[model samples]
Target: MTSQGLSPSDIASVVDALRELRVRSLQSRRRINNPPRLPSRKALGAVVEELAAALFPHRLGADELDDEGIDFFVGYTLDKCFRVLEQQVRRELQFSAEQAGSPVDGIDERAENIVRAFVSRLPDIRVLLDSDIVAAYEGDPAALSVDEVLVCYPGISATLYHRIAHQLHRLGAPLTARVIAEIAHSNTGIDIHPGAQIGPSFFIDHGTGVVIGETAVIGQRVRLYQAVTLGAKRFPADENGVLIKGNARHPIVEDDVVIYAGATILGRITIGAGSTIGGNVWLTRSVPANSHVSQAQTRSEIFDGGAGI
Candidate 1:
């Protein structure tokens, strides 16, 4: 009720007027410049779907695939995938370049090269993906078959995409890598950056909320339960206290390591080979080889109150 201040109704009216002005300005700008069109995530997801069909036709598209028809099917799929993914990769690269205020030169050539290299490496990636399937089948008692794991398990699907996209990421095709990973993330709730180096025979059991940061190196035969985080403890800041990008801030899990659920091992530390990290543990320091980290054991509660409830 102060004389110097506006009433609540007046303030609300002023806010509404400003919102109307903003909407009008936005509509005018849209008419003038036409809203920028980005590629569809669903289209990118189709790329993964097609690539999966191409990679594992026998399993993913058994009814459609035959020994005699495989060559034609693969050829047709590759042709379509290359064309569609090329456009997506181009758009992603162009958008990223514009955001950075850089020129988007040689994008076509780079995308072509990326697609070619990725296709060529598909055979090898499939082998690794097979390893993952085998690992999952062997690890899980409920798994019906390798095909079941590949076709139905989100973890296996996410891992397959990660392995495929990791190659593109290493070949300096980050946009393509991002597209591939995003495809997996869309299909499955798992988010693994393609820049993370994961070795073969890796398994993600009940894989949800698993975050493996860029620059994290996971070795062969490593097993991760759900909610395991390989992240940075603290970021390294620049001169003005801004955090540096693309630094090696995540942990390294060596060969044959097992990280259980809800375990957070952070910050450039090495979990040496053949180690077993217990569930719900927080590890910030380096663990030596063949170490078994678990909670300190205590005597059973049966001794309390003469074994009564």
Candidate 2:
């Protein structure tokens, strides 16, 4: 206030305006009391990183540790991650219950059970991640090694977050899942919804501007390049002009399909198995299996030097 040369009355006026705005916001939006606070994004991000480290201990975790020490470190990291995640899951469930006006009795046991099931799925997630790393290394000519893909690729990072977040979304913690996915989105420009069902060995090259919608289904060994979108073509509206929810809107990309950069495949159409979509192609309809789609050929013309401008 001193630096800006604002008087006491000016400050009071601004505060009063802000208070009125806050009141208006409360009246317009849903209201709650004593709502359980979800875990911070930073904390959830740390949990994901710790889990990644535990999964690839020697590569991403403490490389200095010996065989026995590596096992111990992994165990410790897993336990710590699980404990923190359980607490967050509990808070999420409690918040949901409060929002629904449901009783929260025995929510602790339910959260613990959910977390235990989630923890048990870590090995399977690791196996899937291994396939993803291999796919990235194999698909990219510039990739030197699997370790390089795991450690350096933005696509791998986003996929890692998606895999973890997808599990959480399936287990009834979509808000937490979305937070985890957004962490990856902020770090890398890839925006993949946690509700998207993606198969193993999915690889994205130069991942900036890639968007996968919530209803998108991707099969195994699918590779996509930069600026590729699997999006909804249109939103169905009701009589009141409100957009309908839960429709199958995004594309289904089948196995072994390679979609090149700047391709937009929209709506519920299926890109059939073993198809190749060329760069900058705008596609909407479903294609047969093994189809090859590319932009229409363009003709170039040469102008004479004496041509009028």
Candidate 3:
């Protein structure tokens, strides 16, 4: 206030208006006391970084570290990361329970269990991420090496967030998992849902504007280019006009399928194995195995600034 020479009464009036809005928002949700807060995205970002470093100690971790130093750094980082993660888990559990009108009597136990299960899946997740990294390197000729792909690719970063978020989604911390996924999305422009089931050796090249929906199931060795979407064509609503949830609404991409840039495959259809979907194609039906789908060939025409075509 002093820097800008603003009056204290002006600040107080603004705060009063904000509080009125907050109260109205809480009442609209029918929230009881609004439970204090949920997990913080900033905190989860730090946790993911620590987890990434733990998984790839040499690449994501400290570069100066030797083998023994690597081990120590991983151990220390994970210990720190887990503590914060567990607290976030507790917050999410508490918030969910409150929303459901349930008591948070055993949130601590549930949070600990979720974290324990998440920890158990780390090695497997790392193995899956390695497959993705290798796939990106081998699939792209411009890629110099797997290490470069791991360090440089947006797909790698997005999938790493996916790998962690997917596990957490399965482990019952979906809100936290979704927050982590959105962090990657906001940074990389690849919006892969935490609930999506992506298989091993998935490669997304030039992965900007990609959207894989919640119920999308991608198979092994699938490759996708920028601006591809596996989305739901329609929403099924109930009698009260509320959209039904948890249905398999997105596309099921089969093994070795390649979806190119600007392709939009919608509905609960299957893209068969070894198929190649060309750029800017809008598809809604299921295709057979080894099928090739593309947009219709356009006529060559020149359009002047006027009405000429």
Best by TM-score: 3
The digit string of per-residue lDDT tens for model 2 on 1-309 reads 448688899999999999888777656655533434775798899999999999899899975989879989999999999899988888888888877899999889988888888888999999999999999999999999999999999999999999999998888888889999999999999999999999999999989999999999999999999999999988999999999987899999999999999998889999999999989877777888899887762101112344211
- TM-score comparison, 2 vs 3, better candidate: 3
TM, every model: 0.82, 0.87, 0.92
TM-score-based ranking, best first? Answer: 3, 2, 1
Per-residue lDDT of model 1, residues 77-176, tens digit only: 8789888877876776676666576987998887787778777888898899989899999988999998788878889989988987788788766766
Rank order (by lDDT, best first): 3, 2, 1
In model 2, the runs with Cα more than 4 Å from the true position are 1-24, 27-32, 297-309
Clashes of 2: 0
The true-versus-predicted C-alpha distance at residue 265 of model 3, in Å, is 0.3
lDDT for 220 in candidate 1 is 94
Listed per candidate, the RMSD to the true structure in angstroms reads 9.1, 6.1, 5.0
Tens digits of per-residue lDDT for model 3, 1-309: 347765899999999999999888888888637535789999999999999999999889977989768888988988898889999999999988877889889899999899988988899999999999999999999999999999899999999999999999999999999999999999899999999999999999999999999999999999999999999999999999999999999999999999999998889999999999999888877988999886762111112234221
Cα lDDT of candidate 3 equals 0.91
Candidate 3 structure, TM-score to reference: 0.92
Instruction: Give the clashing pairs for model 1.
Output: none
| Top-lDDT structure, candidate number | 3
